[model samples]
Target: MEPTSDFDPARLARSLLRRSRQGALATLMPGTGDPYCSLVNLASHPDGSPILLISRLALHTKNILADGRVSLMLDERAEGDPLEGARVMLAGRAEEVTEAERELVRRRYLGAQPSAEVFVDFKDFSFFVIRPSGAHLVAGFGRIVDLKPGQFLTDLGGATPLLEAEAGAVAHMNEDHREAMNLYATRLLGADGADWICTGCDPDGMDMQAGRNALRLDFPERVTDGTGLRKMLVRLAGEARAKG
Candidate 1:
């Protein structure tokens, strides 16, 4: 057999956060002291903080307003047996984002949930950020650990170059780089499909989606700007072509 890669739980946990764009959010019910769970679509800040767009009328949003304490659960949904894959319960307090950060957070949310554009600007809707304090990660059966925020989250080298360019990059790829995107999905990830599209990208890597399937591809280096992204894409495409 060929040599296996080294295991890094922290890195795996970070990837899980990156790939997960939606999860169940748990909040404390007002006056009841009971736990309330609701589904929430999420995006990540460059530093891996969870960003959410919710309406004031939402029960979960009301709960957050009543008590900022909350938890977001993201997990890998595998077929067959569900517990075989990894899952994370991130405990954090949700804070309503201020005006200065609204656009930044909005763009991030749209990058993950493009459909939110319809109701994103409603008068009752608002944006919130969940600052994770700790996490409980179960990476398969025997692999489990409790991690601090720093261990499971990444800083993205401090420059959010890709964040600003995310929308344009995704559009350019889908409109002009279909073949290359499909090649990356099949060659690099060994995914069994050809209809893949580049949905979003960040400093760490890019995500590809095809029907119900999703795949993540890492950059050769931490890329922040268009020049770095172009160079990396060119190299990856060339390598994919050669391998094909």
Candidate 2:
């Protein structure tokens, strides 16, 4: 495999925060004085904080309001090979979102899970934002990466160069360089020519139409325009040639 970039804790955390599906939420049971754990679907805010859309009447939701202390574990369930994946657990305080924040939370949550539209109408269902006090990241069996509380939960403000570069890379690759895609697929990804097709592009990344799934690549280098993108392609092509 090509040399992977130095493992970026923030980037890795952001990636996991963006992609994972289910999370285990541990909440306090009101009068019982015990902790209640429930499997809930969750999403991350743009800055990588965890949030949950839950029913106010649900056991966990009620438990949270009664006592805001809670912990959320967002991780990929081990399947097949255990050594290749990672997981993150976050401990935090949960609170019902204020009216001003509800709309933004709803948009992000609904965008990821359109199916929730069916049950979102329930009067009991509401949005809860979790502000993590600490986090733990595990990359594989026996490989521990611990982080301080609130490490990945900060607001960094408006878009930065990384985001713009990633977007420009995607747009240029998808719109102007279709032929180069198949070459990269075979030369870089080591795929058969038939397995590669350019599907779509945006400012963030390029989507490859591979079989049943789409593969997205977020370019790490700056690519602001067609000229800059061409230079990137040339560099990639030179790398392929060097490997051959």
| TM-score computed on alpha carbons, candidate 2 | 0.63
Q: Candidate 1 residues 75-132, lDDT tens each?
A: 8887778788888899989999999888778876776677898999999999999999
Each prediction's Cα RMSD? 3.5, 7.0
lDDT of 1 at 55: 93
How does residue 96 of candidate 1 score in lDDT?
A: 99
Question: Which pairs clash inside model 1?
Answer: none
Q: 1-244, model 2: which lDDT tens digit per residue?
A: 2223566565455556655556888988888879789999876554556668898778888888789999877665557775467777788799788997676567556645557889976898888888877777877544566676445543434334433354445446557766677767667757566545443222233335444322334445635445554565677766766766
* Angstrom error at residue 182, model 1: 1.4
Using TM-score as the measure, the top candidate is: 1
Worst 10 residues of 1 by lDDT: 1-10
Off by over 4 Å in 1: 1-6, 157-160
